[model samples]
Target: MNRINAHNLACPIDGALLVCHDKQLRCEHGHSFDIARQGYVNLLPVQHKRSRQPGDSKEMVAARARFLNSGLYEPLASRLARITSALVPENRKTSLMDAGCGEGYYSDTVFKYLEDRGASSGLSFIGLDISKPAILEAAKRNRQITWLVGTNRQPPVTPASIDIILCVFGFQSFEGFRHILKPGGRLVLVEPGPDHLKELREVIYSEVKKSRPQDLTPVMETGFSLVDEQSFQYKTGEISKHIIADLLLMTPHFYRTNKAGREAAAHLEVLDLTVDIVFRTLEFQNP
Candidate 1:
């Protein structure tokens, strides 16, 4: 949080600059947001919320945190950091935003990697998620990360203040991303591939549909051109029943699964699964 200055933040309502002092963020228009006891700030205005509780629930957040802590996705995290670090230009300070950052796992990993490479002084890390529990959990992992319970549709960040935006297995707000990124800034996107957890799907569902191919056309329409993309696959060796249950809980399928599917996953003894993912780099180009 120390690396994020007041200049980097904006009032969610009026888009005015915010000044942080005494754990409170205030704008010139008299809008004030208090930093939580957990060190995260809530910038999600009620008007922007579609439900009483938007985004991942507390249970989902906990499941993801627990699963990620097991380091099953460390390869994806490392690749993300490597790709992001390469996209950020050298010899200058850079601001990075992790849009829909879940539990700060990816952001924290990337920040640590950058710092180890002697880029800490020149990098600013901001992690935003609509879920308060997720942001609170994220803040606990690294106090230096600027954690915010904010909507990605309208992030609480100044226009053109960010150099790199990361949208990993989360929502992609093209306009919001473009508004906050400087011209030529990059967006590193990660999405699940067809075989991503194929074994789990097979075990849980009677008919496991093949994953569809991603169309970059939508991204291109948002004033971004694809720069680079890489697909990654790794084996989980032999996973335990506990991990199987955790994996089910961590995915969206958990909500849609039937009682039988749930029981099958819960009763699994051992399963070998493949972790398949794709990373895409898109550079913003103003028309």
Candidate 2:
């Protein structure tokens, strides 16, 4: 069943340790966050929220759920699981946090992969996102993970405690990550490569500029050194209009594109896409 490592969580308001009490998370400073009926927790304090709604909207989360559940991205998920499994300690308890885990597709898939390999015992999985809608959707995928609605700038996980942090195409707070990750802990990032969804970009943008996926030099200077990097790429034969729409909705391009670009996409009966992803692992080191 799903369980939470409440022992590692902190109160967003006071930065005090939080524990599960009476189905709520309470800290010593009297700060309490409620665990929703869906079994996820809302740890994002109102003060920390940038707007009335901070992260992805409900419609975006729904589209993300639909696209992910369709298994078109299963190869990516499988590669992530394989990479994560290699980093897990064999005999010790470990904690993994999926920062900005949208609807829990990757986390859930990784959990099942580890479980199938008999490597899931004594592991705590946390799925965190700024979007309540995303966390709400994630909580339904697997009860084994602790899903929280919280911002990355101030993640509630305790300092120097997390074993691994996995972020996929999300905004990151490197300072926050450095604070929470243990020495020698790994940070895995999955970023889009230069040609990732180029076809889609061609349809939606007046001009497309393809560049490096990311530069880790700044991150390396911040106490994290690159450990490994791998490129994963694939092409789909043809996807239907409905799937294409769902894909567009699940990405930021939907909001960035003009109406004419969107209408052009809508009229396409089918389109093939190139999925280029870079999987990088960086290790946090003590100063």
Candidate 3:
């Protein structure tokens, strides 16, 4: 792990600073998390766990990895990279953390994108997820990124040390996020738009509810102001049955769908999917 990046980590037990010592991250209070052979660390403590298996399952991660690796979401990834790169100036050190980074897809893509753009001023990329399987799969994407098995509620990161926090189609705990980001730091968030996967929803449910835009009042109440916003749609050409299956597994709708709904989706030969996404940037206002 990079020394600077390691400094950004904190103890999950007590939120104390952590030091990398002998292949483990140890805190002043003697709480320690061992580095796994896969080059990631598990920082999730038992008390913080919501369940025995908290986050994404192994099967879900595997399906997501397969789907993402196929480059179906490359456009979204590229857009994220471009937008994020534009936000950071080229001549200064920048620390970016991905909250709930699954399989490290966006993080890896953004890392490479910044490198390609020659913003070499010093980029520290960290990805954290509650799922061990997700972090393990993420580790395979890029060893340079610090992947931690941690939760958004109690992120294993130093307070006010991050420049940007990326929450791409993931959970965002306003309190936790506000605590970790430096003053004036930005949060780049990507969420599903109303029309996102409409066709798939139609197949999965008999009646579809209208999709409403995400309300940011709660986020704004936490002393963050919206800086910019954009919405766009990406339509896939002809998607195969295998890709359709992957899509179903990658989304939350899969678990909520009825037996008949799942059967209908499973029998699909091909589908042309429309992916609508909304991007927003919020900057923290230091008091």
Candidate 4:
């Protein structure tokens, strides 16, 4: 029998209760969503869609996959796995939803870790991204997990159904997240620390601006209380010029970097990339 983690879901269309049963999730108004053969459920409603395709492009997805597979961010993934594992209940089935799950690198890694510990049967992993190409690539690489082309603003699950919600280096919709997570359900958010990618910033611009890390207070204000927090740092080895260019294009820094900056990065010898990864675990609180 396939046991889906359905506690963190809600009807995407009307914000009503969603019943996940017998491989189908049905809302009170007779709207039904089928669970894909590959084990993922698509909760994106047509009205919420603004574009034919969304989120990261194929180029960005490929570049991210390459960079991640190069082991540049293994430590970050490991840290996330450890934290997520600790949150699972001992006997009950668990479900994890990765919002903006780009290319499935982090989701696949974490799911594998849990599965290796005999937690596979009790856990279901869902990777949701707005980009159809990203969802396609993720589904191709990790067939065991569910991948959906959807947005964080309108996740396709039932309200208060998920046990864990993960947002890694992607946009977050706190209200949407709060609505989907069960009471006491945990939200694991990974964001770039202040010093993240300092090397790349240095090479791309004459002066690097030291921006403050994201303020979680706003999220807290939306009814999430911080339960735990941690930070990890590591250095990634040299990358090819072409890969480096792709990395720049896939990141927010690309827009900030000027033409001269791009030319400078294009001719760099090697980049000593540094990653400052911050992890925060939050629990839903009453609004």
Local distance difference test, per candidate?
0.86, 0.90, 0.88, 0.80
lDDT of 2 by residue, 86-200 (tens): 9998988899999999889999999999999888887889999999899988999999889999988999988898999999998778888999999999999999999999998
Q: Judged by TM-score, which candidate is best?
A: 2
Task: State how far residue 177 of model 2 sits from its true place (Å).
Answer: 0.6
Q: How large is the C-alpha RMSD of every model relative to the true structure? A: 1.5, 1.2, 1.5, 2.9
- Count of backbone clashes, every candidate in sequence: 1, 2, 0, 12
In candidate 3, what are the lDDT values of residues 46-106, reduced to their tens digit?
9999999889999899999888988978999999998999978778998899899998999
Candidate 2: 10-residue stretch with minimal lDDT: 1-10
Better of 1 and 4 by lDDT: 1
State every prediction's TM-score relative to the real structure. Answer: 0.96, 0.97, 0.96, 0.88
Minimal lDDT window, size 10, model 3: 1-10
**Least accurate stretch of 10 residues (summed lDDT) in model 4?**
1-10
User: On lDDT, who's better, 2 or 3?
Assistant: 2
Which runs in model 1 stand beyond 4 Å of their true positions? 1-6
Task: Write model 1 residue lDDT over 166-197, tens digit each, in one string.
Answer: 99888888889989989999998899988989
| Candidate 2 similarity to native, TM-score | 0.97
Q: Candidate 3, 196: how far from true, in Å?
A: 0.3
